[model samples]
Target: MAIQIGFETLVEDLPGPRWQALFARLWPGYRAWFLRSGAVARPSYLESRRALRQHMPELVPTWQRLVELAGGGDVEARFLSLWCPPPYIVGCSQAVWIDPAGKEEPALLRNYDFAPALLEGSWLATRWQGQRVAAMGDCIWGALDGQNEAGVAASLSFGGSTVSGTGFGIPLVLRYVLEIAQSTAEAVALLQRVPVSMPYSITVLDRRADWATVFVGPDRPAEVTRRKAVTNFQHRIEWPEHARATHAAERLERLQKQVDGPGTLEDAIGALLQPPLYQSAYLRGYGTLYGVAYRPASGRMELLWPGVRWPQTLATFAEGRRDIVYTPGAEAPPDPDDAALAQLLTESRS
Candidate 1:
C-alpha cells in the first residue's frame, strides 16, 4: 500500500487559534484511542490533573490552557493529562552524534518508525512555556521529539516490553523536558522525576557535546547512561520476540557504530536513510516514516527521507505542508513457535 501523509508546520507561540483548530481535527480519533477499554479504564479527571501538577508542575499553566482549548470536557482534560493512557508501541532507532567541526557541535539523529496513518505529522515552533521550542507534536500538545532554545534536544524509542503501569505517557514527559531543561544533564534529571507508563529510551544531547541515553519505564527507576545510541530495547533485550521481529538488535548495532564513528552530521543522516536502519515493515507495526536531526549548537533541525530534506531553525521556521507517500512491505509471516509467542502475549500490559 502507498500511504500518503500530510505534515504541517504550525508556527504559534502559545495555545490559541491554530492549536484549537488542531485539537478540533484530532480530538475524535484521540478520544477513541483513549477510551479503547472504556472511560473507566483510565484514571478519573481529577486524578489525571493531580498527576500532571505533581510531576510536571511547571507545565500546569500550559496544561490548563491546552485543556481549555480542547473544549474543557472531562475526557479531554484526562486525555491531555496523558496520565496512564493506553499502551502504545513504536519501534525506532536514535543516536547522539557530534559534529567533526572545529567546535564539535552535537546532533541528535533519530528515525521515527511507526504507521503513517497513526502519525499526527505536526511540526511546531512555539514558546508556550516562555522558552522557544521546535518539536514534532503529539497528543495535541506533547512532543515526539524536540529541541529548546537553550540547546537541549531529545528523542525517544519504545523500550521493548509488554509491561505497563500507572504513570504518565512518555510524550508528555518529553514535552516537559523541552519546556524547562537547559542541558543534557538537566534533561536527564528532569526525566528521573516523572513516572512513565511504558518503557522508553530517551537520548538527550546538548550543545557542548554533553549527551546521555536515559532508560525509563513504569516499573523501574530511570537509568542514565553514557550510551550514544539506542533502539527499541534497553539495558538488555527484555522482549526477545519483539527484539527479533523488529530486528532491534541489528538496528542498535548499526546506530552504535554510527554514533561511535568520527562521521559528520550528514554522514549520520546518510546512514539512517539506508537499510536495515531504515525500516519498511509497516504491516508489522514499525516503518520508518521520517528521519530527523537536531543541531543544538546551530539552533536548527531537519527532517529526512529517501530524497527529501526539510530544514528549519526557530528564527526561520516556515508554516507549510509536505504530503509524502510511503510504500512499505507487508508483515512478516508468523513464527513457527506459536506457543511461546502466545505465552509472551499473556503478559499483562495494564
Candidate 2:
C-alpha cells in the first residue's frame, strides 16, 4: 500500500481565517521543536523583525500583516527564523535545466531531505493568488520551494558548510523570491542582495529554459554557475564534518549520470526514488517526504511517489487536492560509513 500524505491548498488573501487556522494547527508543534532545539542564536521577535526590515524590507509589512491576520496573539516573527541557523540537514539533491530537448519542457526536481520530525503538522501547500506564488512549506510562513506565476521556480539545498552567521534563513529568502521575482534573471539579482545566515544553494529556472545555481552563505561571497543540477556542496566542501556525514556527491553523480544519458524527466524522477535521493530511514527522520517537478512554462506541478502520481495547477489545486502519505515500502541498508554521522546527528539533537 502507498502512503497517503494529506496536502491542503490555501488560496485566500493574506491574513484570512484559514491562515489563522493553519497557524493554530502548526504553531504548537513548531514552538515545541524550537524550544527543544535550544538554538543559541535564535533571535527575539523584535530582533528578527528588525533584521527582516533592514535586509528584506519588502517583506516586513507583509509579515506584519500576516501576524495581524493570524490574530496577533503571542506568536512572534522570530519563531519563523528558528530553522534558519542551518539545522543538521544531511541529504538533498536538485536538478534544474534537466531538459533542453523540450522532451517535457524544462523542469526542476528536488528531494527535501531532513529530519521527518521537523515537518510535523506542517506539510501545507499554498497558492497565494494575491502574491501570485505557489509554494510548499510549513507554518512559519517560509517557502521550502516554490514557483511563481511569473514562471520562475527556485529550490534549495544545504550548501554543505559549517559556516554560520547572523542572517536570514533560506526558506524565507525563497518565499521572498517566489513572491517577487518573475524570471531567473530577476531571481538571481535578488539573491545577490539578500543576506543569508547559513550556506545554501538555490537552483533557479525560468520558463525560457534559462537557469542558474547560486551558492551563498554568511561566510563567503556568493558564487553563481550555469548548471543542470546541484547537490549539497558547491566549489569545495568547506565543511569537512558534512563531507564525512553525507552522500551528496553520490546523489549528485546519480543525477548527472541520468542527465548525461540524455535521460527524460521520468528517468530522473525514477532515479530520485532510489537510494540516496529517496531515503528510507524514518528512524533518523531523513526519509524523502515528497518529490515535486515543476513546469514553469505552464505553471503545472506533478507530485510523484511510489505507486502514485497527482497533478495540479495553482488554480485547480484550490478547487480540489489529495493527501499523499509516504510509507517506506522497502528499507535500504544504511551505509556503514555514514552510520556514525547519522548517530552523531541524532545524539546532537537528543
Candidate 3:
C-alpha cells in the first residue's frame, strides 16, 4: 500500500497572505524538532527568522506563526515525520512524464492515490506544505527525494542490517544540505561534519555536475563511495557480513552494468524503475518509493510516483503555472522518449 498525494501551483502567483497562513499552521512541529536536536548552527530561531526576513520578508510572519504553534504543544512526534528547510533562492530544471494529451494511458508518471486514513485533516495540510518554501520544498518533498533549487539532489533507502548510525535521518539531512549548501562539493563537505543517526547511503548531485555517494555510520564517515548507480543500501565496501548481506550490492552491480551499456540518465532512471534485485529476499522488502528529475537551469522539478501498487508519473514546474499531471498504469519503457529529455540526459551524462 502506497500513500502519495501531490498538487501543483505556481509559487509567485499564490496569494502571499494565504500562503503565509498555511506555513504558520505547519511550522510548529518542524521547528520544534530542529531546535530539540541542537544541531541547528544558529541557536536562536529568531536569528534564523531574521536572516530569512532579509531576503524573503514575506516569510517572517510565517516564521513567527510557527513559533506560536510550537508554543501550543500541538506539535509533537507527529511533526518529526519530515521537517524540511525553507526553499533556497536558486535555479532548478526538471522533467517527468505527464499526460500532455490527457490520454489517461497507463504511464509511469501519474498522481498517487493516498490512503484515506493518511488524508485526515492536519496530516495532509502539514505534509504538503506546497508553495510555502518553493525552491527549498522541491528538495524536501518525498516525491523524488532531492532538492532542485540548490542544484542538489539525493535519494535514500533503509539498509536494514548493514546500516548503523545515530544522527539525523537522511531525509532531514538532505533538506539541511539543500538549505545550507550551494554545490555538491559543499553539500558533501557539510555531510561529513553532521552527526548522522542511522547507517544509510546518500547519493548527492550538485549543480556543477559533481556527484558522490557517502556511506554514514554512528561513529564516523565510513566510506565515500563513488558510483553512478545507487540503490537503497550500501555499495561495494568491505564491512562485516552482517552489514554486507543486507547492502543490496547485486542490485547496484546490475544497475551499473545497465548504465554502462546504455550510459544515460534515462537509462539510470529506467533501471531504477525496475523491480527489486536482491537474491536473499531481504532487499525485496525495501524498493524505490519514486524517481525524481531536477533541472537546475530551468528551476523545474518532476516526480515519478510508482510505488508497490500505484504506478504513475507526475510533473510539476517551478516557473510554469499549471496543474499536476497524473497518468495511470505503465506506458512504454523510457527510451529517450522526447528530444528535450534526451538532451537533458546527455548533458547530465557529460
Candidate 4:
C-alpha cells in the first residue's frame, strides 16, 4: 500500500483547535525522539529559548504562536524548536549544476533518508503567508528541506560531525532561508551566518542556476564551496564515527562522475536513484523516503518513488497535487485521544 502524504497551506493565524489536534497527533513520536538523546535537562528550556532568541530572533514569534496553539508553555517543545541534538540524522545525497551552455535550467536532486518512523503521516507541502515549502518533520513550523516561490531550492544533509555546541537546528534554518532570502547568493550568506547546532550542509539553487553548498556548525566559521555535489562530509571527515554512516566520500565521487559524463538530466537522476545514493526502505531506520528534482527557473518540481511521480508548482498549488501517508509498521498507532481531538479540530475549523 502507498503511504499517504498530506498537502496543505499554513498561515500564522492558525486556529487553536486545529493546531492543538495536529500537535496531539504528532507530538508523542516527536517527544520520544527528543527524549532519546537525553542531552537537555529539564531546567535548560529557558537557556535554549534565550539562545534561539538572541541568535535567530525572527523565529521567536513563530515559536510563541505555535506554543500558544499547542495549549501553551511546554518547555520540551520550546527546546526542541531551538535545536535537535544528535546522533545526527544520516543518508541524504544532494547535487546541483548549471549548464554553461544554458541548455537546461539549474536543477537539484535530493534524497532524504532518515528513520521512517519520523516521516510517517507527514505533510509534503506547507505554505505560510509569504513562503511555501515541502518538509517531513514533526515540528509544524520547520522543514527538513523545501523550495520557495522565489526560485530558491534548499536542501540539507548531515554534515558528518559529532560535535555539538550552542547552535540552531538546520531545519529551522532551511525554513528561514526560504522564507527570507530571494537568491542563491542571499541564501548562502544566511547559511554562512546562521549558527547551526550540529555539523550540516545545505545546498542552495536559484533561478539563475547559480548554486553553492555551505558547511556550518557552532564551532567553526561556515565553509562555502561551489561544488556541484555534496554528501555528508565536509572538506574532510571530522568525526570518524559518522564517516561510514554518511558515506560521504563515496557518494561525492559517484555524483561527480555522473556530472562529468555526458548525459541528460534524466541520466543524472537515474544515477541518483540507484545503490549508494538511493537507500531502500528496509526494516532499518535509515531509509529513503522520496526523491525530488527541483528546477528553480520554472518552479517545476516532481516527487518520485519507484513507480510514483507527483508534480507540483508554487503558482498552482492549492493543496498538493497528490497526497500519500507513509506509516511504517514500527510506528505507534494514533493517540487514543485522537477521535475526540479530531472532532474538536473540525469544530474549530467551522
**lDDT, candidates in the order shown:** 0.86, 0.70, 0.38, 0.67
- Cα RMSD of all models vs. native, in order, equals 2.6, 3.4, 13.4, 8.6
Query: Model 3, 1-350: lDDT tens per residue?
Result: 23333333334432344444545654543454344534443224343444445433433443344444444332322233222222111111111222233332111111111112211121011212232123223212222244545555554433322333334445455545555566768767766876555555556665455667676655556467665554444544433332232234555556556545624544444555554331212111212223455444334445543332211112332332222222332323333434433332222102
Ranking according to lDDT, highest score first: 1, 2, 4, 3
Best by TM-score: 1
lDDT of 1 by residue, 47-156 (tens): 99899878999899988898888878999999999999987777889998865554557789999987677789999899988889999988888899989999999999
Write model 4 residue lDDT over 87-176, tens digit each, in one string: 345568888855545587778888877655455434445454446655444355566667788889988988876567766767778878
Candidate 4 residue pairs that clash: 3-324, 3-325, 4-324, 4-325, 5-324, 5-325
Residue 104, candidate 1: C-alpha displacement in angstroms = 5.0
Q: Model 1 clash tally?
A: 0
Clashes of each: 0, 7, 28, 6
Give the CA lDDT, 0 to 100, for residue 42 in model 4. 30
Q: Give per-model TM-scores.
A: 0.94, 0.86, 0.51, 0.81
Candidate 2 global Cα RMSD: 3.4
Q: Report the error of model 4 at residue 146, Å.
A: 0.9
For candidate 1, give the lDDT of residue 344: 40
